[model samples]
Target: MTTSASDKQKSTEPVTKTENSETVTKYSRLPETKNSPVRRNNRRPQKSFQGSNVSGPIFQYFMTGDDAQVATTPTKKRPSLGSLSDVGSSFDGELPEQSPRKMTICEAIDEKFSPVNYSACSFTSIGLSPVKHDKDGTVRVPWTLVLEDRNIAFAGDSDTLCKYCGNVRDLDLSHNDLQSWSEIVKILKEMPHLEQLNLGQNKRLSLSYDFSTLVQSQYTNGEQSKAEKPLSNDSPSTESCPGSEVNDPQTEHDVQKKPPVSLPLTLPSAEGLRGHRDDFVHTSLKTLVLINTGAPMDTIAQMLPRLPSLEELHLSLNGYKQIENSVMKIVEPHSRVKTLYFTDNHFSDWRDFAKLGHIFPKTKNLYLACNQLPCIDISFEGVFTSLESLHLGGNKLDSWDCLDRLNELQSLKSLRIHDIPFYANYDPDPTIRRSLCIARLKNVSHLNGSAVSPDNRIDAERFLIRHYLDHHPKPQRYFELVDKYGQLEKLGEVDLSPIEQICLQLHCSEMEICKEIQVKPSITVLQLKTCVSEIIGIGLKDFNLFYKDAMMEEAFGPVGCFSELKLMSIQLSTAGLCDQSELHARTISRHHNAQRQPSR
Candidate 1:
C-alpha cells in the first residue's frame, strides 16, 4: 500500500512545484484530510498465521510471470504432531520405524534448516505464536510483521503464513536490532498499505533521508518531455549540441537540461533522522514519534513542515537546552497539530513558550515540568485560549506575574504550580502590615475574578507558608510564648512542641506571623486574650510600651523610642529583689537625676 510518486503529488494538490527548482513550495490542508485517498491507500495491513486443525501436508504456490515458465519450490505445510500417524516409516516400509510423529508449529519454526521461508511470501495479515524464537535464539514473534498490507503478530518466532491479512494500517517493530532505516524503508516499500510505523527503542535506525530532493528530481525528470521546446532560428545545428548525434538543432537543444541536485541517500549521523525533512514532504506520513533519541533540533525543524497531517508529537527526555525557536516558526504554519509534550528538558525561559500560542493555536495540553526556568514572563493574554491542561510544576519562580497574565486564559481547566516559592517579605509595623495585606488582597481579588475557584485561596495560603518557611528564621519562641500564656488556645491545643524547640534553638521570631496578626485587629485581640494570664507582673502599660519599642526597633533601630525603652526595662529587671518594689517609684526620679547629673 505504498504511495506512488504520482499519488503523493496528487495528495498535495493545489501545491505546484515550479520547474525552475529554485524555490521549495509549501502547502496546507484541512483537518478532514485524514480521510483522504492518499492516507487510506497507503495504510499497511496487519499480519497473522494461526490455525486450529492440523491439516495434512499442503502446498502453496505464488506465480508471477505471464507465461508461467518459472516454478519455484512449493511451500510445505506440516501437520501438528498429534495428527500424525504413530507408525511412520523411518527406514523402510517393512520396518515401520517411527521418530516423533510430527513437529509442532513451534518446533517447525525453531528448526534452522527447515525449508520454510515465510519471508518470501507477501500476505496481508499474520498472527504468530508467542513461544516462537528466531535464528539468533531471540524471541522473534513479529512485534508487527507486515506481509503486503496485512499485519501479523506471532506469539513466538514461528514460521507461519499470514492467511487472512488485509492492508496494514499500523506496524510495530519496537524491540529489534533492525539497524538501518533502509531496511525499514525496504520493508515499507513492499507494504504499500503502511500508514503508521513504530520504530521506538531501535537505537541504530533513523528516518533521515532528504526525500524532497528525490521527489523533486523524479518530478523534473517526468516533466522533461513536456518542457521541451523548439530551438531558436539562430541556434547551433543539432549535431553541435551536446550529446546530439543528429544535425537537427531542435533535438540538440532538447538534450541540454540541467541536472538536478543529488542529495546523499545515507544520513550524516548514525541516527538516520537527517533526510526525514524531505521524506515527509514527498510521502504521506501523518504521525511520527521519536522519544529519547537525540535527534538534532535543526533536523526536526526542517522536517516539521513536510508532515501536514501530523497531529501529535512526543519528544520527551531529548536533552534539549532550549526549545528551538525554529520549531515554533515551522509549526506556526501548521494548523493540524493539537498536542505536544516536551517534559524533563532544559528549557529555562518562558519566552520560548510564548510561541506556542502562535504556532499550535489549538493545542489543548502542554506539559513542561522539571525544567530550569527561574521565572516566566508570559504577558500575551489569551495566548492559550484553547489550552485546557498545563503542567508547569517543579520550577523556580518567586513571583506570580506569569500566573497573573494567565488569568485571561479562560479555557484553562487544570493548572499545576507545584513546588514553587509562594511567600514574600513581611514587616511587623502595623501600618506596613496593613499595606502589605491590602496589596495582597487586591492581587487575590484580581485572581478571584478569573476562572480560578475560591478554593484557590487555600492553595495560595499553602504557597505563602512554604515560602516563609524557606526564607524566614525559626519563630518557635513566639509559638512557645503563646502556648505558655494559653494565648491562641486553639493553636496551642495542637502540639506546639516542634515549633517551640525550633524557636528556642534559633532564638528568633518570624516577623511574618506578627505582621499577619497586626494587619487584622481581630487577630491582635485574640493574641492579647490568650496571653493575658501569662502577664502576672507585667503591667498592661509596660507591655504596650514594650510592644511599641519592639515594633519600633524592628522598623527603625537605635534612634527609635524602643532603643531607650529597652535600656530602661533591662536596668529595672536587673535591680535587686528587695529594692524591686521601690525601683518603680525611683525609676522616674533616677531618670531625672541621671539627666541632671552629667552630659556624659
Candidate 2:
C-alpha cells in the first residue's frame, strides 16, 4: 500500500467525539465514495462511549481510514477463534464480495472475530442468540455487535447482545430502538458486569395533552397556555396522564395494563427500576450516557440513586431549556456522580449553582460546553471546586471577572474556552487571548486542546502581571494573586521598599533585653502597634506603639503611607547615637498596655 505525505499523520490529537461518528482518538471522515463497500449502510453509533469512568475497559474502537482501511487498535485480546473453523471456510484477509456483506450474523460470528485484526470482516446483520455455557464459543461469542437500523433483529430481553456481553464491562447500545424505560430495564437485568452503558437515540415517547408536561412546557416558555389549572390525579386513565389514553385497542390495552402514575414527573423510583422479578441490580456499571434521548432531567434524576455505582452521567443535546424544580430535587447537592455533562442544553443562570454545592463530591471532570451561559459568577465557583477538567467552550460567557471566579475553583487543572463571547469582545489576537487565559487559570495543565508548557506559563503569567499592574495596580486581587503565583519571573520583578533594623529594649525588670526587628522606611504606626501587641503579650486593643513626643501624632497620621518626618528623625538619631540603639517599649505606667481606637 503506497502512503502519501498527507496520509502519514504527525500530530498527536487525543480522542475527540464529533456530532456524527464516535471515533476513538478523533473524528475522521469515512471513505465517502459509493464504491467503498466498507462504508456503514446504517447510521454510526449515536453517541460517544464517553470514557470518563476509566477503570474497567477500553473497547477496541474500529475506525475507518481514508482508504477504506478499517483501523482497529484493540487494547485487550480475547481467545483465538480456532474451534468453529468447521462452521465457516478458512479465508485469506479480504472483504466478502457482498454489498452489505455476509459475515455480520451472530451465528456466523461464532469463532471468527479477533481483536488483533478485523479489517476484512465486514458484516451487515446481528441476530438474537441465547448465551451458551459451552467453552470457546461453540454457539456464542463473548461480545456481540448490534446496531439500531442495521437490519439486526433485537427481540426484547432475549437479545443476545445483552446475554453474551453480560460479564464484559463496557457496552454500547447506541441507536437502538429500546422504546420504553421498562423495556430498557429488562435488557439491563441481563448485563450483570456492565461498567458503562451508552443508550442514545432511542425511540422517544409520543406523549400529548399531559397536564404536567403542559405546566412544565408553559413554565419553560415563560407563559402558561390554555391549561392554567392542574387536573386531579384521582381523575385518571392508565396512560401516564389523565384523559390521554389512545383509541386503538393495542394502545388502550397497553395503557390499561400499566398502573396510573400519581406524580407529575415521569421519573421512575428505585422500586420501579427493579420489580419483584429482577435477578440482580448492576452496581458494577459506572458510566451512563443518555444523549439525544429526549428524557426530561427529572426522569434522569430519578434514575440516579437506583444506579448507585454511576460515576459519570452524560445527557447532551436533550431539549432541556431550564433546570427546573423537579430536576433540582435530585441533582443539586446530591449524587454519586463524579463527572456530569449537560452540553448543548442552553442552561444560562449561575445563581442556581449554589444548590449544587455537594453534588459530585469526588467529581474531577465536568463538561458543560456549547450552551447559552452568559457568565460564571463568584458564587458559582464553590460549586465547581472538585473539578479537575472542565469544558465550558462555546458558551456566551463575556467578561474577565469570570476569570477571577474561575481561579477560585482550586482543584481545576484543565479548561476549554473555545468561542466564548469574551474572546469575541476583544481584538482577534489568539496569542494574547491564549496567554491571558493561561495566566488567569494559573494552575491549568491543559488549555483548549494542548498542554501548557512551563515556559509558556511563565511568559503568560508575566504578561498577565504586566497587563494587570499597568491597568489596576493596587487591587487586593493583585496582591492575593501575586502572593500565590509569585512575581512573574525576571521579566516582571516586583520591587520592595528599603528596610532598616530597629533594636527595641523592653522595659521589663527581669533583663536588659533588646529585640532586633526589620522595619521598612514607610512603616505605619498602626502596623507597629499590632507588632507591639504580639511581642509584649498584650491584647491587640490594649497594646500601643505610644510616643509621648507631642509632634509624633501629626507625623504618623494618615497623610501618606506613614510618618515620614518621624522616620527621618529616627534615621538621624540612629546614625549619631550608635550605642546599641536601645529604644524603650514606651507605655503609660499609670494605665499599663494603654491602647485605644485613638479616639476614632
Candidate 3:
C-alpha cells in the first residue's frame, strides 16, 4: 500500500470554491518551509501564571496524536493556478538524505574527551551530562571540575546544566545569551555556595527582579508583616491585566516560598543596569570591578556605603567627570578597604585626595594616573606613612617641589616619575642646575653630600643687598663729624678766643662738636691753650710738662676761673686727637718744638 510522490502531492493540493455563474476561488497549500498561517495566528493563548506580575514565565506546549493530524475540506470551485505536475518539473532529481548521529548525553560524557586537570581546565565549552573517569569509574559534573574557589561560567554555546556544585565561591556568566532572568535567578538561588556573580555583556538579562517583595512574602511572620509591611505600596504600582483578579494570600504565599539559599552575588549587564539597583546585594561583596559599566557616580556613591565587607574597589575607565567629596565621606567609614583605583577618570583637582588621605590611612597602593592634575600640594608625610607606592604620573606638573613634604614617608620605596612633566624635563647632563632636584635629594634619606649647583644664587644676593642698605643718610653724617671736629682744642684763664677760632675754622655744627669733644678728663690752663692751638693747626710745643701742671692748678683755684675751658680742652685732647703722633704731625709741625725748647 505504498503511495507514489505524485499521489502524496495530490493529497496535499489546494481546495476550490465556485461563485455565482463563472467566477471560481481557490486556496493552495503553502510550501514545506512555511508554517501553517492559521496555526501561527492561534498560537498565542492568554494564559498567566503565578509571579506573572513580577516576571513572565516562558511557555512550552506539546500536541497529542489526534491533534497533530491535518484535515482537508472539499470546495465546489476549480483551481485557476498551475497543477502539481508543473511544480515537480522544477527539481532535476531526488535529494540525498543524511543519517543522524546517535550521540546521547550519557554517551558524550562517557567518552574521555580530555583529562580534567585543575591547572589546565580553561574549558570554553561544557556540554550537559557528567564526565566519567575511566580509571576511578567516577562521574563528575562540569562545575565540580573547578579547582579555584571562584568559578566563572562563560560557556557560549554549551548550555550545560549548572547545578550540584555547592563549592563555587564566585560565578561569572558573562557573554552567554541567557534570555531568561527566571532561569538565572533559579540557578543563583540553588547554588548555595556561590558568592560573587558576574553577568556582564549579557544584553538580554534584566536585573529588576523584586527580591525584597519575594523575601518578605516568603520569610516574614504575621507579626513581622504587621510591624513592617510586606512590600511598599507607595512604590508605583504596575497595571494588572484589565479583568484579571489578584491572587489570594495563600496562593501568593505558596508561590513565594523560599528556594534554597544561594550566595549573595552580583548580576551585571549593559542594558537595564542604570535603573537596576535590586540586582546588587552588597552585604557579601568584598571587591567590585565596575570598569566601563556606565554606572553614574552618584549611584555608585549611594550604593558603596551599604557594602559592609567591601575592601577593594576599581572604577577605572568609568568616565566619571569628578568624584564628589561627599562620595569620599560616605566611604570613609568603611575601615576594611585597603586599595582604591580611580585611574583614567580625567580628574583635574587633587584637593579631593586630601580626604582620601584621612579616610584610608592604611591604603598601600593608590593609582591616580592619566588625569589632568596641574597642581598637587598635599602633605604626604603623616598620611602616607603606610603607603608603599603612589602613582601620579601623566599629569601637568612643572616642578617636583610639591612633593617636598613627602620626605617623612619612610615606607615609600619606589616613586614612579615616568611620564611626569618634571621627570620628562630631566636632563642627564651633570652640569644642569635644578633647584627642585637638589632640594628633593637633600631632604630624602640616604642622599647626603650631593653637590648642587647654586641655581638661584643671583636672586638670593639681590635680596640680601636690598635688606642691608635700607637707610644711609644718618651714618654718613656721623662719619663727617668725626673727621672734622675730632681734634685737640685749647682755652685760657679769662679768654676762650682760641676755642671760638677753632670752631669757626672747622664750621662745626653744635651737635657735631658736642659729640666729638666729650671724651677727655680735666686739664690745666696751659694744656687747654695748647690743645686749642692744635685744633687750629697752631703751636702745641710752646708749653712744657711742668708749665702745663701749673696751669691746671691755676684753672682749678678760686672757683675755677677757666675750669670749663680746661675741661673742654682736656676732653677734646684725650678723646683721641692730641694724644697720638699721627694726629699731632697732621696738625702741628715737629720743627715748632725746636723753636719752643731748643734743638736736641
Candidate 4:
C-alpha cells in the first residue's frame, strides 16, 4: 500500500482525547525499521506516565519473558512431624522400627495439634473452646483429644505427650493400630486424671500374648533344655501332652521307677501377674473401653486390679467363648466395677458367663446381648447378688424356664430380654412380648426399658394365667398369683371382624313393648334414634331413652342426643311423664280404641 508523507507524520505522533472529563492518550501504529521493530526494553530502562485506562501501557518485555536475574520471592517452610526423636525412641546407628504406612500416636498428635494450629483444635471437654490465653497469659490447651482411626501404632513418649495434652480427661484413641498393651499403659500412666479411655478396634492388644511369651521363655530355659539333655521316651510331645500321658498309663511300680510326667507349658504364677498388674495402675480412670481388642478373661484379670476405681468396663467382640479356670483363679473379686458390657461376644454356655459374677461380684449393670446363650443356668444362684440390670437381648433362649430361673437374682429389677426365640413364637406385638417377660420375671420393675407399674404387673400376671389356663400343667407363678389375687376368670372371646355388631335388647315401659335388635355400635346417637324408630314403630319424640349396663349401674338417667349406645341395654319411657302406670293406661286405651274402630 502507498502512504502519503502527511499521513505517515500523523500516524507517528500520539493521538489524545477526553473521556469522562479525564485526559486519555491513544497510540498509533509504529513505523517499521530496517534492523528490528521499535521496542522498549523494560529490564534496562522504564518510563512513567499518568493518564486514564482508555489505553493501558503495552510493554515489550511482558510479551517475551526475562530469563536472567528474574525478581525472586522466598518461600516459607512448614513444620512437620519429625521422626522417633520426639517420642524418645533412640536407635544409636539404625532407624527405630515402624510401619511406613502408619504413623505413631505422637506423630499424629504433633501433626494435628501443632502450636501453629492450636487455634483450630476443638477443645471438647472444655466447652469446645479453641486455644486461647488464660488470665495468667499462658495458652490453655484442650482437655479432650480424639485421635480415632489415625493408624496410630505407637503411643509415643509419655512425658512429651503430657507436655502437649496434659489436661486431657476424655481421650478417644479407638480404631487405631496400637497393638502393645505396654504402649497403652504408657498413655494411662501419664494421664492420671483421664476418666474415659476408648481403645476399641485395636485388635492386637492382648495381655495373653505377653503371658504366652513369658511361658515360652520359662519352657525354653527349663523343660526344653531338660528334654534336649535327656533324650528319652519319657519326654512328652507338645502337640498332645494329655493324649500321650493317657495312652501310656503307668502302674504304681512304673510310676515310682520313672520321673513324674509334666506338661511342656505351665500357668504363670500369681506373683508374676502381680508384677504385671503393678505396671498398669490408673486410680482415676472410671471407664475403660477395649472392644474387639482381642483381650480375653486373662487380660481382664490383669486390668481389673490395676484400675481400682474403674466403675465401667467394656470388652465386647473379643471372641470370649469361655472363661479359663486359671484366669478366674487369678482375678481377684473386684467390687468397684458397677457396669460391664460384654455384648457381641462368643459366650454360648451359661456357666461360662456366670464366672463374670464371681469376678466382678458387685457389678450392678451387666450387658450380655448378642451372644449365643442357649439358656441361663438355674443352678447358678447366689452369684449375681448385686446385679440389678441384665440385658439378654438377641440371644438363643427359647424357653420360659430360662427366664423363670432369673428369679434367683433377688436384686435384678431391670431386665431386657427381647429378640429371643421364646418371645418371638408368641407374637410379634411388643405388648405381648413384654407381658410374657414381665409375667416370668416377677421382681423386675423395668422390662425392655419401660417401667412396669403395679397395675401392669397384675394385668401381666392375669394374662399369663389365662394364657396357660388351657394347658394340662401350669407354672408355679400362676398358682402364686392365683393365691395372691384369687383365680382370675377366663377373658371373653372378642369379635375381631371389621365393623363389629352387637345385640341390644330394647324395652319400653310406657308402650309395654320388648324387642331385640342387631346393630353396629359405631353409629351416632341420632342414627341410633332413627334405627329404633324404624325397628320398634316408635316415634322419635314420643319417648326418652335410658341405658342400663350390667357392669356399671341398674339404670342411667334419660340418655341425651350425644350419649353413646355401646354394648348397653336400652329402656324407653314416655317423655315428661313421671308415673309409669298412667302412661301405660293411656297407651292401652289408645290401642283398644284403635282395635274397636277397626280399619278406616
Using TM-score as the measure, the top candidate is 4
Q: After the best TM-score superposition of candidate 3, give how far the Cα of residue 111 lies from its true spot, in angstroms.
A: 20
- Residue 329 displacement in candidate 4 (angstroms): 2.9
lDDT of 3 at 161: 23
Worst 10 residues of 2 by lDDT: 48-57
Residue 446 Cα positional deviation in candidate 1, in Å, after optimal superposition? 19
Stronger candidate by lDDT (2 vs 3): 2
| Candidate 3 stretches greater than 4 Å from native | 1-166, 173-251, 254-285, 326-332, 381-385, 408-410, 428-600
Worst 10 residues of 3 by lDDT: 149-158
Q: How close is candidate 1 to the true structure, as a TM-score?
A: 0.38
Tell me the TM-score of model 2: 0.47
lDDT of 2 by residue, 1-600 (tens): 875655544321224545567344442445444776545433333221221121111222323334333333323343343332322223547644432211222212222232233444232223322333333322233443344333111322233334344565665667544434543444456666767777776534211122233223322323333422322221112222112222568855664566543445543344544552432245677888788877765655545556778888887888667767656765534356788887887677764444444556667787788988787754654566677888888988888777778777788888898888879988699999888888777678999989999999877766776667657534344665687677764454666843354443334222343465544434455455556556766654432342223244367653332222233234423323222333335333434434532545
- Candidates in order, TM-scores: namely 0.38, 0.47, 0.36, 0.57
Compose the digit string of candidate 4's lDDT tens values, residues 163-192. 444567888989876646656766886677
lDDT of each: 0.41, 0.52, 0.40, 0.62
- Per-residue error at 94 for model 2, in Å? 30
Give the Cα error of residue 259 in candidate 2, in Å: 18
Ranking by TM-score: 4, 2, 1, 3
